[model samples]
Target: MSEPTMDHHRWGMVLARPRGLLTAEPFWSETADGIEEGLQHTQILFFLHQVPGLQEELEVYRRWSAQGFVHGVILVNPLVNDPRPALVDQLGLASLHAGVETPAPGSASIVSDNVESTRRVLERLHALGHTRIARVSGPSHLAHTHIRNTVSRQIAQELGISVRIVAGEYSEESGRRATAELLGLPAAGRPTAIIYDNDTMALAGLATASALGMQVPDDVSLVAWDDSASCQLASPPITAIAQDVHAFGRTIAQCVRRIESGESSFEVPEPAHHWLRRASVAEVSPPR
Candidate 1:
């Protein structure tokens, strides 16, 4: 088969992760490395803007699409009722969306199975004898957060576990504040285990737990989504849902290459997410 020709030599990606993720988090850094590796001849440009509102993202896409500044673009952390897909279709732009289940008519997607992974984590906690659990989730606007929160609550109900959810901005500060709030509840009402949406927040939760004089896996357990080296570096290490973020990036790059080559029927496989057991969780003891 003949190789597809790319209209533009440069591709672009806009990321909406916490600041310093590319440098601080191995997952983001490794994914960026993978994207670079997957590029054959075309140059990829990245716009690192943390939490740029949906409207701002739309403008960036519009300006770039209109100017032909980039041959293609990748969008990360899509919102509920996202308009990027429709905008991409209208602008005749070549694009890919990461972690979005429903792509616009003209774009392709590389997504994680949020619902399944969340269920697995919750099930493991329940099996460990934890009855009261809490989650520190990312902003409610992102589709993945909503999916995870929904699945978490649903499975907790099914398992007859008590669940509490707190919202965060995917920031360490928010994680710290949320952790403090959860820990402040009456001893009988506090959760025995806490789940964070990301490793950064998980680390913050660990710190907060320490400041509050709580022992992990004894007084409370910690788990995080998006596993990274930092998870293993903690005092007790952390349990996490590990996803192949590097592979996720490479898949997005591949999809962009295919779209650039004029391929219309492309499907990026959903990346797998699984539990990574560590020292963070322990079996609950029978109350006296």
Candidate 2:
């Protein structure tokens, strides 16, 4: 099939963070080629996520749609949840579908199952005989927190377990603060296990536990998601759920291709999380 191309005056895009540490340069160069050949000069709008004024960028995109100059907006970071509600009350759900002046049929997004993955990590904790468990979650602004929080609550209810949730912003500092908070609880209130959303937070938790003279799987067990290189290099290797990020990027690119081709939005197949068996968890011992 021939590659689809947009007319000079036809298409526009509203990109977010297309040039970040996470972005692959070659892929972006290809995307730039498509936009240049397929769009009117005024039709393309690129907004970096770290830009000072996001609202202003979105406003211009909204205006393009309002004036019927653009077909729709394509967000680069498909993982991030809707920020319109918090950013602009005028641009709520209703306005989104109608104001864009395009049918919502082809709108697509992609994200990992934060809830199910966290549940798996929690189940591993339960298997280790950990009754008291705590969670260090990433920022609440994104939809990832919503999924993780819901799944955690469900698992805890079914297993008759309790989880203490500490909010962190996916940074070492936030991780440290959360770990300190977890350690401050009374002996009886302290969790026998702690889980983090990402690998970085997990490493911080381990460091904090060591500072408090707690040994992994001896005093408390540890678990986290996204098995990064740091987890493998730790003194006692960490157990984690690993996602194929390269495959994830390719899948997202495919999804974008489908949308660009005017195809219906389709759900991407669920990516399996690989469980890395390691020495972080030990069988729970009964009270001495």
Each candidate's TM vs. the true structure? 0.90, 0.69
Tens digits of per-residue lDDT, candidate 2, 66-142, equal 55544444443222445543332343211211112122354454434655677777787787678788888866754
- Over 141-248, each residue of candidate 1 has an lDDT whose tens digit, in order, gives 899999988988899889988889999877888889999999999988899999999888899999999999999978999998889888988989999888888887
Model 1: residues with Cα > 4 Å off, grouped in runs: 1-7, 17-24, 41-51, 103-107
lDDT of 2: 0.60
Cα-based lDDT for every prediction: 0.79, 0.60
